[model samples]
Target: MSIVIGDIAKECITVDPSTKCQNVYSMFEEKTALEGIVVVSEEKPIGLVMKTHFFQKLSTKYGFDLFMNRHIDLVMGDELLIVDYSIPITEVSSLAMNRKQENLYDLVIVTKQNHMYGAVSIRELIMKLSELQIRIARYSNPLSGLPGNNVIAETLQEVITYKRFSVFYIDIDSFKFFNDTFGFREGDEIIKETAVIISDTIQTTDNEPSFIGHIGGDDFIAVIPHYHYEELCKEIIFRFDRYIMRFYTEEEIERGYVQGINRQGILDNVPLVSISIAVVHNKQYPITSIEQLSREAAKIKKRCKNITKSTFLALTE
Candidate 1:
C-alpha cells in the first residue's frame, strides 16, 4: 500500500494576511504543533508563514516594538508549494527530503480549488513514513480522516479505568436529510467543519485533558472530567448549533424544517444539522459490570433521542 499526503497532514491553522503579528504569535503559542500558518483571504490560501519568521523578527533590535505594530502580510512567504489533496505521500516525502535550506519550505499547503483545506509538515510526514512501515492499525475514518469507532471504544475503556470523567455522545440531528438534499461532498464538508468546531471548542475552553473520538458518520464522543463536562457540553452545543444552522439555505431556513417521523407520525421542525448530546459521568458508585454501565448510559442516550425538546442531556444515575 502506498502512503498518501492526507495520511500525515496536520490540521491547518489559518490567519488573515491583515491580522496583527501579535495575534499570530499568540496562536502559535497556543498551538505548538503549528509548524506553519496559512494566510487566507475569502477562504482562499494566499501565502504561508513559519515559526522561524516570528523568531527572526523577535531577535532584531527593538523587535518587540516592531512585532507589536507589524501585520502578517509584511513578513509572510508569498511563494508557497500548493498541492492537491490526492498527491501521493511518497511524492510529498521526496519533495521534503530533497529540498535544501536555501530552498527550504518545510510545510506544504493543500487545497481544493481556491478554498483552504489544510497544511502538512515535512517532519510529521517523515514520522508518518516510519510509522507506516510498522504494523499499526490506523484508527481513521476513510471519509473524514477522523478516528473511528474502535478508537472511541478503547478511549472510553481507558478513561473509565483510570480517571473520574464524563463521556458525551454527540450526534448531528437530521444529517441524513442534509446528505440527501445537498449531496455527499457537501455533507462531508459539514462533517469536517463539525469536527473542527468540536476540536477547537475543547482545546480553547477546557483546561483538563480531553479524549475526543469520532464514532463514524455524524457521531462524536468526548471524555472530560466531571468538573468541566457541563461547561464543555454547553460550549459545544452553542458553537455547533451556530455553525450548523449557517449551512442551510435561506429558503429552507425560513420554511420551517421537517425531519423524518419516528415510529409514530410526528412533525419535527428542527434545523437540519442540530446536535444531540448524551453525557455519562464516571463516579465512585459500585459497578457490577462495565457492560451494564455502558448499557445504562446508552439507555439514557436513547431516551434523550426520543424527545425533540432538547439538544443536550446528562445521565444523573
Candidate 2:
C-alpha cells in the first residue's frame, strides 16, 4: 500500500559538472524526447538542466556564444527539487508544487541513500499520485473507512433539529488495556470489529432513520429511533461479547484480564475489552443543546463502564 518516489522514477540521462555545455546541447539535440539532464558528482546529484529552460536561456542575446563553450555547470539551472527515493510520493508532491514557479516543471531528482537514483517527471508524479490515491481509497480507508467527527457533529444537529432520535455513544471499555498489552495494530483490528457490529446492528434496527460515525479511534456515535433503541443496544452488546472474544486468547479470557501500565505508569491487571453504550434521547428529558446531550451521555457512559460486562445504560432525568 506504500508507494515512494523511486517506484515511479524513469531513467534520466546524467552528466558530470565538468561536462561542456556544447556536449549537453548535442545530447539534447540527439534525443528529441529528452526532458532534462541531471548533473552528478561522486554519485550524487548536484543540479538539474531542463530542456525548456536551457533553450530559453540559450535563445537569449549572446546566450549561446557566451555559454556554449563553458562547462555545463556554468549554464545549468541550479535551482533544483531533489527528493529521496524512499520518501513517500504524497509528501514529495507538496515539495514539488511549492518550488519557485520557474522550477515548477523541473524534473525531480531521486536519490537513494543520498546517491543519484533517477528522475521523476511532473507528469509521472501527478499520474502516480492520483492512481495511488484511488487504490488507497478503495482498499486502505485511508485505513479507518468511517465517516469522521465533523459528520458526527452534523448527525447530532440533525437529530436535535428535525426529530426525536436516540443517541448511542459507543465507547470501548479499557481500550487502552488491549492497546497497551497487544500493541496498536492488534488494537486497530478490535476497533474495526466493533465498528462492524455497530453498523450492522443499527442498519437492522427495523430500517429506522439512522446514521453512524467514528468520533475517531475507539469511539463511535449512532443515531437511531427512540423507540427501537433498546433492542438495538442489547443486540450490539450481545454481538460484541460474542464476536470480540476471538481477539483474546483462552488463557487471557480464563484469567479475565491482561497486564498493562496505567496512565500513572503503574502496572496492573486491566480488564478484558468490553463495549459501553450510553443511550440518550429527548423523550424523558428536554434535549436543549448538543452539549447537554453530551453531558448526559458522559454520565451514563461512566456508569456503564462500572459494570463488569458489555452493557448499555440510558439517560434518565
Candidate 3:
C-alpha cells in the first residue's frame, strides 16, 4: 500500500487558545518529547508554538512577568502549515520545500476535514520522503531512472482522486521499425531521447508541476492539471518532431524512411519515427479507473497513429 502523511503523523500536544503561557510552558516541561504544541479553539487549530521560540521569549529579562499570565494565543506563532491527512508524502514534500527558509524546521499540522488530526515535523517529513525516494529508485527504469509501473499506478490513483486532471499517454510511432532497422543501441538512444524531450518540455513550462513516469519501453505517462495538459502536449510533440531526425543517419534522413522486416517477416519501407500522444481528462467524462483511462488512451493513440505525423489527440468527448 502507498504511504500517506497520516501514516507518519504524530499525535499533537494541543493547548486551548485561552490557556495561559505559563500553563503551556508547564505542558512542555512535563512532556519533554513535545517539541511544539498546537493552539486550538473550538476544535480548530488556530496557531502553533515551538519550544525553541517559546523558551526564547521567556528567557528575556522580565519576560515571565509580562507574558506568563497572557493567553497562549497571544504568544503563539502565526498560523501553522495545515495539510490533509490523506495527502501522499511526495506532495507534502513539495509543500514543505516552499515554506520560508527561516521557518523551514517548523511542524506541519495534519488535519481531517477542518479539524486538527496530528502534526509532523520537518525532520520526519524529510526522512519519509527520503525513504520513499529510495524505494522508487529501486523500481525506476534503468535508463531514464524515472518511476516505473508501480509508481505510475500509485500516481495515477492519487491524481484521479482529484477528479479533475489530464492523463497524457505517450508512445513512439514506428518504434519497432526503428529498432529493427537501427541496432538495439540506437533504439535505446531513441527511447532515452524521447524521455528527455518529454521531461524538458514539462520542466520548462510555467504551469504547476506534473507527474511523469515511464511505463516501460516506448510508452510514458504524464498526469497534469487540465489547464496545462494541452499546451504541454503541443510542446512535446513539436519539439520531438523538430529534433528527432538528428539521431538518424544522413541516408535515412534523405530517404525519410527505413527498410525493415514487417511483423509478418515481409520486407517493407517504414516511415521515420514519430510520436503519438493521447490525452484523456475528466472535463467532459467521468474517468473512474486506471484501466478505463488506459483503454481510452490506447484507442485515441491508434487514431493519432493513423495521421502519419507526430501529433496529439485529446479525448474531449
**lDDT leader:** 3
lDDT tens digits, residue span 1-317, model 1: 23456555556788888899888888888988667788999988888888877667777999877876788898788767777665656566666667667436558877766577788877676677777534224777666655677766665655666446677787877677778667899889878887887777764323344656688889887666554567777888788767766666778666657455533455555555677778777574633444755776788778767754336777673
**What's the lDDT for residue 36 in model 1?**
78
Give the per-residue lDDT digits (tens) of candidate 3, residues 188-275. Answer: 9878888888878764335344777899999998776554577788889888877787777889878878777888899887778989
Q: Which ranges in model 2 have alpha carbons more than 4 Å from their true place?
A: 1-141
- Angstrom error of the Cα, residue 266, model 2: value is 2.1
Error of 1 at 271 (Å): 5.0
**How many residue pairs clash in each candidate at the backbone level?**
0, 0, 0
Ranking by TM-score: 3, 2, 1
Record all residue pairs in model 3 with backbone atoms less than 3 Å apart, i.e. clashing: none
lDDT of 1 at 3: 44
